[model samples]
Target: MLTIRRHLVDAIVEHARKDHPDEACGVIAGPAGSDRPERFVPMLNAARSPTFYEFDSMDLLHLYREMDDNDEEPVVIYHSHTATEAYPSRTDIGLANEPGAHYVLVSTRDEDTHEFRSFRIVDGEVTEEEVQVIDGE
Candidate 1:
């Protein structure tokens, strides 16, 4: 299961809405090995495509350096789907690099509703997981 704060979940949804028509992508970093998402880092979708998302290469490189300096690891790797369900696509599965990270997908297919789901993608396999949103940070 992926245990996360409510506020963080809200932030991700907000970001996804703000970038509707184009997929929004980002990372939530936390203390190394903790698996607790503490810091939200919204990223630019380099692809800027409604069907896909790609983190800017330079931005991703910088984030990795910053995380290393802070002894942090990406606990959550998230992206929004503007017109699809909250499930990983074949491309998404192929691109999953962080076996330990929670892969979050938020679907903004409906104007008044959205679907939020989490998954574990390791070695080209995907497994849906439960998400427990808590009240506080």
Candidate 2:
């Protein structure tokens, strides 16, 4: 299960909505080994495609460096799907290198509804997980 704050969820949804038609990608970092998500780091989708998302290589490197300096790790890695369900594609499972991170997908396929889902992708295997959103601070 992935337990996260409500405000964080709202923030992610907003980012996704803002980037509709092009996938929005980002990470939520937290203290190493804490399994908590506290910092929202919105990222550029290098691909800028409605069906795909790729973090800019330079930005990813910088983010890793900063997270290291701050003693943080990416607890949640997220992306948006403009016209699809909130589920991982085959490419997503193949590209998931962080076995410990929660992979979140937000779908903005409908104007009236948003689909938010979380998964764990390890070694080409995808496992859907429970998400518990807590009240905002």
Candidate 3:
């Protein structure tokens, strides 16, 4: 299971709504502990497609270096489901590069509300997990 912050979830929902008719992608960075394996630090992705998403390699690389410098790690990769359910697509499953990282999906198909879900994709198989959002500090 993944424990995301309430503020982060709200941000993602807003992003999804703001990017209506297109997909929005982002990165989540935080410490990983036994009790809270994944925490979220929402990031914006300038490069996104309506039907797909691709992290900007340059931006990602820069953020990676920055995170490393800050002694933080990206624990989750997130994207929005603009017109679909909060589930992984075949493309998303196939593009799972971080087996250890949580894959978060925020569904924005109804009422512009956010329904966050978590998953882990390994070897083309998707295993759904529970997501608990806690109030932010």
Candidate 4:
């Protein structure tokens, strides 16, 4: 299960909505081994496609360096799907490299509704997981 704060979830949804037709991608980093998402790092989707998301290689590298300096690890890796369900696509599965991270998908297919789902993708296998949102720290 992925245990996260309500505000963090809201931020992700808001970012997704802001990106609208384009897919929004980002990461929530926390202390190493914490499995707790405490920092929100919104990223630019290099692909800028409605059906796909790709973190800018340079930005991703910088993020990794920053995380290392802070002793942090990505707890939640998230992206938005503008016209599809909140589920991982084959590309997403194939790109999954963080076996310990929670892969979060937010679907903004409906104007008035959205779907937020979490999964574990390890070695090309995807498993849906429960999300528990709390009041916050």
Candidate 5:
């Protein structure tokens, strides 16, 4: 099972809604352990593509360096599907380099609006996981 903060889910939905026609992306940071293998703090990357997201290499480098400085590693990567379901695309699967990190998808294609899902892609295989959003104190 995958667990995420409620605020993180809201932020992802908001980002997806705000980015409408394009894809919005960001990073998830937290502890990845057996007891809580998927707990994260979502960080919105203001730097994103309006038509296509090509993970800003500079921003990625900065984020990595910052994480190193703070001693917190990026445990997951999230992106939105403006018009499609919350699932990985072929390109997404092909470009995913982190086998141990969670891949989250937020879908904003319906009238009700918010939908979030999490998955893991390893060796070209995609496995969906249940996400339980926990309200933080």
Candidate 6:
């Protein structure tokens, strides 16, 4: 299961909605080996396409350096799908290099409704996971 705070969920959804028509991509970093996301780092979609998302190479390089300095790991990797369901695409599975990260997909196809789901992709296989969004105090 992917356990996350409500505020984080809201922030992610808001980002996806704000970037509708173009996919929004980002990462949530947490302490090494914690598997608990604590910091939300919204990223620019280098592809700038509704059907795809790419992190700028420079930005991703900087993120990794910062994470190394902070002793953090990306616990969650997220992106929005403008016209598809909240599921990993073939390209998504191919691009998932972080095996330990939760691949979160938020579909912004409808105007008011969204389908937020999490998945684990490893060795060309995908596994749906339960998402438990807890209220933040």
Which candidate wins on lDDT? 1
Q: Tell me the spans in candidate 4 whose CA falls farther than 4 Å from its real position.
A: none
Better of 1 and 6 by TM-score: 1
Candidate 2, residues 21-130, lDDT tens digits: the string is: 89999999999999999999999999989989999999999999999999999999999989989999988988899999999999999979999999999889899999
- Cα error, residue 7 of model 6, in Å, equals 0.5
Residue range 1-137, candidate 3, lDDT tens digits: 88777777777777777876677887767654333333344455555566687777777888788767766666778888777898999999988987877888888778636678889888888999988889855
lDDT of 5 at 102: 78
Cα-based TM-score, every candidate: 0.99, 0.98, 0.85, 0.99, 0.83, 0.98
Q: Give a tens-digit lDDT track for model 6, residues 26-110.
A: 9999999999989999999999999999999999999999999999999999999999999999999999999999999999999
Q: Which stretches of candidate 3 lie over 4 Å from their true place?
A: 32-47
Q: What ordering of candidates by lDDT runs from best to worst?
A: 1, 4, 2, 6, 3, 5
Clashing pairs for model 5 are: none
- Candidate 1 vs candidate 5: the lDDT winner is 1
TM-score of 4: 0.99
TM-score-better candidate, 5 vs 6:
6
Candidate 3, pairs of clashing residues: none
Please list the residue runs of candidate 6 whose C-alpha ends up more than 4 Å from where it truly belongs after superposition.
none
The global C-alpha lDDT for each of the candidates, from Candidate 1 onward, is 0.98, 0.96, 0.75, 0.97, 0.72, 0.96
RMSD of 1: 0.4
Candidate 5 wrong stretches, greater than 4 Å:
31-51
lDDT score for residue 17 of model 6: 97
lDDT of 6 at 111: 82
